[model samples]
Target: MSLPRIAVDAMGGDEGVRVMVEGAALARRRHDRFKFLLVGDEMLIKAALENHPNLRAASEILHAPETISGEEKPSQALRRAKHTSMGMAVNAVKAGHAGAAVSGGNTGALMAISKLALRTMPGIDRPALAALLPTLGDNDVIMLDLGANTECDARNLVQFAIMGAAYSRIVTDLDSPRVRLLNIGTEENKGTESLRDAANQLKLAAQGLELTFDGFTEADKICRGDVDVVVSDGFSGNIALKAVEGTARFVGDLLKRAFTSSLRSKLGFLVSRPATELLRGHLDPNNHNGAVFLGLNGIVVKSHGSASALGVANAVHVTARLLEENLIERISGDLAKLGGHGLGNGRAAKGAAAKDAAE
Candidate 1:
């Protein structure tokens, strides 16, 4: 296999260069074709790599000499920390030095710097960061804009759905994925004027992209697997995502304590080894390591702020798959049919409700 290059923002996470080095090493250990360009302070990176000499052979260090703090405001930090590792790493991909970039830095700063450095593809007014939300069934549900676009209009939402659907098609290979608007209720005309307007535009985007949209879906329906793509403004999507994560972790702890009590239950757990393994693997947060900021020029993965070495490693692996698949090109090509013209209002074919009432 041909080698693909990835740039790591060595100063992004709290662990700093140490975790980044370990994550890059983990990727190299798994795939010989994976080469990394570690961008960070020259001295700190060198010292960290001395402790893990194995990384030196497969990864090369790019001296950034500055770091972007997690607390710094996005747009401001990008200007102040012009020489930060995150900025340099983004430049690496923009300059063709890497195929993808991964950072656990301030998400806003990363987004701003990346957009300024690489710019958006033509016809894309705004880029969105897509996230994977854990669902009950086999595969994860795709949610976005993940705080990328806060005040999205109907047109922006339509474009976001198009990008998201392309991602699901390539990543999960779902045939005719169900796209739904995240709303207060499943009933038609249930949300704000913005949501109703967005839903109508979604129908237009769907028609242009040849995607299947199932209309408005309540938050409770996320796990039913009836919808593969859930579209919402970033503010609401992030809240629902965090709430679900907290709930899942709380339930997991409860299950662990329940199984450890008494000899009888312990024996039953031993008998149910396969079942337990299935649940643990499916529910394990580490498996879902990185969230890709889609529609950017190159793949940029934002890992969890508290991610461990294992989580970082999984992120590198995901970056590799995304690059190999050429996800951006696929998305742009598929959605080209979706012109930026105004999408007609999407009411339920008008007055069909009155006809049915008369019947």
Candidate 2:
């Protein structure tokens, strides 16, 4: 098979064309099988490419006259998408010119354009924003619906579980990842009606599904590295993710302060430098920089706006892995096994109504 080509929004990130081009070159060095479609102002992309001879050799530039600003609303961005760098990059995926698209542009704009251009897959009503988070386990955990749909029904939650599990299989190399619904407590009746409903449905289909639906998981237990995938509506998922990010930063900062408190502390820090460096490498967001828009027909990865070249390369690496694994096909197959009674097919609602009537 031919190497997959990734479409890049060279002007999207805070670091602009230079960082994007350098990142692509770094990614190419890691995976020689990858090719890139650099979409942005030709003049700028060319100038950046001059610094990366290998990237220039492996890339094809497509000039986009305009670029989307971070402050632009999704509505306004959609209207001007055709003329924007982010838009052109996404269009490349829709046009089948690129297997995947990666951008560090405005999150809302990227989501809007991806949905409009590639559309959602057959079984998913909405695409979920998923990211790989560091865990204590042998592999990182895959969490979904990070910020796509703020409010989701039971069916939507179920869909997220399926999508998250499929992603885990590819990225973590787990045959049957342990999937869980995020809840306030582990009790079966602890969460909202939607959470309970989704859990019941997952249990009913667990034996046939590709993943192991391990019931409810709490936010605190998420980083313990036991669970493989965590599924939640965007509202809770986003809050939980932010809390985790904040806590990580706080701890890191505290450690730095403690180490610099005095000469003795600084000596201790020097002695433990190797261990601290290892910990830092594991916790670095740049190592896992891709937040994928799952359930879309085509692959789209949202890189952090402030990400470094290494982060950009990691995001591109994620796109390559998704393309190589055929993640969408796996997700579609899993959804298919649920049959007509699956989530988003009125089955969950009908069952819920019957239960309510009985009560």
Candidate 3:
């Protein structure tokens, strides 16, 4: 089936127009139905597109006079949201010219521009950043609130779980995904008041929401693959994400050093080359490149700044899948189910009242 065209910030990533255009071209090759609204310098994009005739035929360029810098603060980038490549790409989504927007630029700037333009969807308190992480099981785990809101309340956590589960269903094709909150321990009473409260709320609302609430999962178990969704506040989620990434790097580096230690080790490396290659492919961030902003009125995917052409294609592919699956409408349907049980409204109000009193 033909999908809506994606708006790509062609000047956002480190390599700028060349890599972005190539990535979009690669994605188009993989899925011929995909079309693009390339936002950046017209001449640069056109030049880059020369090598990829298929993409050039399927894409349209929206010239952007400025670009947001990686070093710029979110507040600073927000001020220039009119003419910047990242901003205009997001604007295309809001204007109904594109179904989604993809960027490899500043995370804070992308988030700021997306929120201001698309705003949060109905029944959502705050939008969360959700991404798929490699896991030992057959399917990757979906983790949310990765550096979006530094702190989150019980209501926020519950909403994130709902959104994450909706996303999981799309990617994993699971009717009911197992959901859990990230906590210090798996025990119900082990975390903060917010964690505990969110856990309780999820348990009550899970039946109607088409999710199986599995209480809490520790940071160490995030990629175990048993749970489908892991919810957390952005501060803790970001830290945990970094720790996992660091561990992957450490393991990869250690293997490299071991393989080069001696002639015998070199022979052993040759013997284990297939397994090592599999490991490398599994851990490569490009394999799981897209981080989506959930609960927004429109789709906006964030690609890693250092992503290669393959990574950009993966991000674009993810955006296409979400659009095809009607992610926003799925989340809205789940939220309506949660509201049907009265859990979202009642618990959120109580949580707010408790916070106000505590303050």
Candidate that scores best on lDDT? 3
Per-residue CA lDDT of candidate 1, range 1-359, in tens? 57568999988887777887788788767766778899998888888888677778778889986788888898787786558889989989998999889998888888888888878876566788887766777777888887887766555666678778877776677866788888899777797666776676666567656469889888888877767888887887877777878888899888878888889888988999899899887767767778888777788888776777887888887788787778888777765665433332223312322332344
TM-score of 2: 0.95
lDDT of 1: 0.77
The 10-residue segment of model 1 with minimum total lDDT is 344-353
How do these models rank on TM-score, best leading? 3, 2, 1
Q: What is the C-alpha lDDT profile of model 3 across 31-51, one tens digit per residue?
A: 788789999999999999999
Candidate 1 TM-score, C-alpha based = 0.85
- For model 2, residues 1-359, the per-residue Cα lDDT tens digits are 89668999999999998999999999889778878999999999999998899989889999999999999999999999999999999999999999899999999999999999999999787899999999988999999899999888777888888899999999988889999999999999899888899899889877787799999999999989889999999999999999999999999999999999999999999999999999999999999899999999999999999999999999988888898889888999888887644544656656764654455
Superposition error at 353 for model 2 (Å): 9.2
True lDDT of residue 244, candidate 3: 95
Error of 1 at 52 (Å): 6.0
Candidate order, lDDT descending: 3, 2, 1
- For model 3, the stretches where C-alpha displacement exceeds 4 angstroms are 347-349, 352-357
* CA lDDT, every model vs. true structure: 0.77, 0.91, 0.92
Q: Number of the top candidate by TM-score?
A: 3
